[model samples]
Target: MKSWSSYLKQFAIAIGVVLLIILVMDYNIRLDELNRLNEKATIVRAQATQAIQTQVALQTQIAEATSDRVTEDNARNNGEIQEGDQRVVPIPATGVPPLEISVPTPVPTRVKKWQVWMELFFGE
Candidate 1:
């Protein structure tokens, strides 16, 4: 009876040691997983901050684009004239009149059917 009890105690200690090793292994694996999750969270936070900055910049651009000054500048660029505004085209001080451009009429030449056939056969 004494030998049997001692053997049982040894078995229990072995089991306890195995369980402790498993617990340590599990703790290490969980710690590594937690580190990876923290890195991912930091990356997500940076991305969110960049998105917010981009949104603010876009909003500012929208406001500027819709402003009255920008509207008037765009209108002037598009050759729009406001009320009570006189548009004066500056003429050169030289008395020479602007030259007129004339397009020459293209003369059409008639081709004979026999010539066309000869040209096709000759590869010209």
Candidate 2:
């Protein structure tokens, strides 16, 4: 009877050990999945932020262009302005008339393949 009890105790311990191992493995898998989900969420948030910023910047540029056009129209209709005449604004202390300067379009920076991949995963 004593030998039977000893064997039963050992069997129970062995079963408990296996269950503990399985539980630990399951916990590790869950933790890994959680980490992956968090990383995906972070990437999505960064992309959204970049998109919003780009949209806002484009809107601001359009608004500025429209405002400039309106100002030019108003000046032309102000009665002091004549057709085919250039509006020369005097520069302070510079003996030179303020000229309308044409801004050149900026050249796009070259992107490396690896950089593009990183941007896709991590965003700018």
Model 1: lDDT of residue 109 = 98
Estimated TM-score for each candidate: 0.70, 0.51
Stretches off by above 4 angstroms in model 1 are 93-124
- Which parts of model 2 have CA positions greater than 4 angstroms off? 68-124
lDDT (10s digit) by residue, model 1, range 3-115: 98899999999999999999999999999999999999999999999999999999999999999999999999998989999998887878888899999999999999999
Q: Which predicted model would earn the best lDDT?
A: 1
Q: lDDT of model 2 at residue 6?
A: 96
Residue 40 of model 2 has an lDDT of: 100
TM-score of 1: 0.70
